[model samples]
Target: MSVTGAGAASSTPASGAGRRVVILRHAETVDNAARVWQGHKDTELSETGRQQVAAAAPHLAAYRPALLVSSDLQRAAATADAIASLTGLEVRLDARLREVHVGEWQGMHADEVRERYPETIAALDRGEDVPRGLTGETRAEVAHRVGECVREVERELLPGETAVIVAHGVSGRIGATELVGLDQDVSDVIFRGIDNCHWIELVESSKSFSARSRWRISGWNLGPWRL
Candidate 1:
């Protein structure tokens, strides 16, 4: 496995060995720039988004990610491609890494969704599972799948190895919270959210054959501007 900036931020004491997992949100997309809901939409990166990657990849290179994994969606894959080139690693694709599926709301603008689906928007804000257009996965569903993805990767990791996961916003947040052992409500408040191309580093360190219950969330929102 590759190594670099995969450190989990946790308050729990360390005992056994643990690995780091970096969860990165894909770069900006045309839909993102337009404030459109891109759930499961195969959107490409915007011009600005490509520039974001060009500027951000070098900073990420410093982390020297050992294994690069990404959502099968083009936007996320494109961003992962930049890192793969920099780190000389191949990108592993997983559909479970894709963003939350918003069903009928794909391509709709934020204002349009807020106006037409006020209850739906409110439900999301409260961390409730309200379908965004008569059909969509609930918050619990998103958390379950993404959490599984994180655990699967974590289980595969040997000591000092790090994996970089490139995905979308909501799913990324869910993954981080789940990995950190935070409940849904608490995670919603703590993670808040991530911007395009930003990333969260969750490190799981263990010592003396004892795994700590708490993981850490360091390096939050590491992005083009911040990096």
Candidate 2:
């Protein structure tokens, strides 16, 4: 999951009846540009990142997201703000939507991680859970909290309304897959990873009895082509 823009997978939205949720990853950060691990470390967006989100605004506005929620982290908040500005909605911040906390690896270069923590890198490359970093989190833990966050956000949505959840790349996959009830065993094959400022849309009929059973990927890796 720490491998940003490193893998590939195919996903198609499934049909079910609740709210359509769009999970938007924050614009590129300094770490993202440099392929460094950010984990929960708060990093600001790069200048190019700002421009990328600006380009994404109009397209995101097309969804007319009813409510905007974001990780309080500055990078995500800033991206959410851009989309909110276009949609004319207020942003609600949720810390649970934050990235996986990779303690000591927060600011290390990706190459360094591969060089020093070969096993850790190898595990992630294999799509296996590795909580080997100093106080780092497992993919399941991240998915658990992210799933809870979406459930709470969905509770506040009205029929046919979309809720945009702005978060980091790792959390985007974990949350999106979790929202669609993607099996953990097959998760690696289902989603490789998401790009910065890109989004995955999960839709469900408002009439669905359970959020877990209703959600499916309606759109994946969507964003302004320029971004």
Candidate 3:
């Protein structure tokens, strides 16, 4: 499915009462190139992934956030380091930001899984429970973890301070959906398939936060290409 674009802000005010959180998915990886389900199983960024993160550094530099947070996963940590180098911001590794654990499916080719476990794939498409391989996490579990992470971000926000979070595709999608209060159906539809390094911007306030805004920031596609 083609992802829709939300236009960028005309001007990011130098200061505002609300907090602006920029959510970035990490750069590409070898698994991403191969279209695998790399949930939680750590993987290093590919050469292109490194370059992509480097290219994104300057764009992120404009935000000037007080803190840069990333998933503890190596790929995300690496990307966060790259941004920290340019922005000179301290990077905090949040384990809550890690990718959705796909259990036994981790590091497996999507096509292979589909062929071997067609029924499971069908069940997932229908939002029904299926065997989540060894060490894998369920969709609901991921949503809860991401929600906690969002709370952490909200707690850490200070007036006029922006925080950048670099995370994985599944968790990023779940977090973005939760931020905007999007219904589960809509959230599932939007996040069912997404590119790596996709950027999502969310505003966190003592009152409300959301992902449904008209403002669109270019997201980095940083994951296994085949999700």
Query: Which residues of candidate 2, in runs, are more than 4 Å off?
Result: 1-18, 205-211
| Over 4 Å off, model 1 | 1-18, 207-214, 224-227
lDDT of 2: 0.79
lDDT of 2 by residue, 1-227 (tens): 22222111223223332467888899888888899899888999998898888777666777777789999999999999998887679999999999999977879997887788887778887878878375799988998999899888878877667778998888888888887788866877766567788888777755568746777676777765634
Count clashing pairs, candidate 2.
6
- The local lDDT score (0 to 100) that residue 7 gets in candidate 3 is 17
Say which candidate scores most in TM-score. 1
Which 10-residue window in model 1 sums to the lowest lDDT? 1-10
TM-score, model 1 to reference: 0.87
Per-residue lDDT of 27 in model 3: 85
Please report how far candidate 3 places residue 26 from its true position, in Å.
0.6
Query: For residue 110, what is the lDDT in candidate 1?
Result: 83
RMSD of 1: 5.1
Task: Please provide, for model 1 over 129-177, each residue's C-alpha lDDT reduced to its tens digit, 9 standing for 90 to 100.
Answer: 6765669787788889988988888878666677889988989988888
lDDT for each residue of candidate 3 in 1-227, tens digit (9 for 90 to 100): 22434313333445656667777788888888888888777888988888777666666666776778899999899888987997788899989999887877887898888887787788878976454653577777877888788767866877667777888887887777766556656667655544555566665444434434422323423221332
Separate clash counts for every candidate: 13, 6, 20
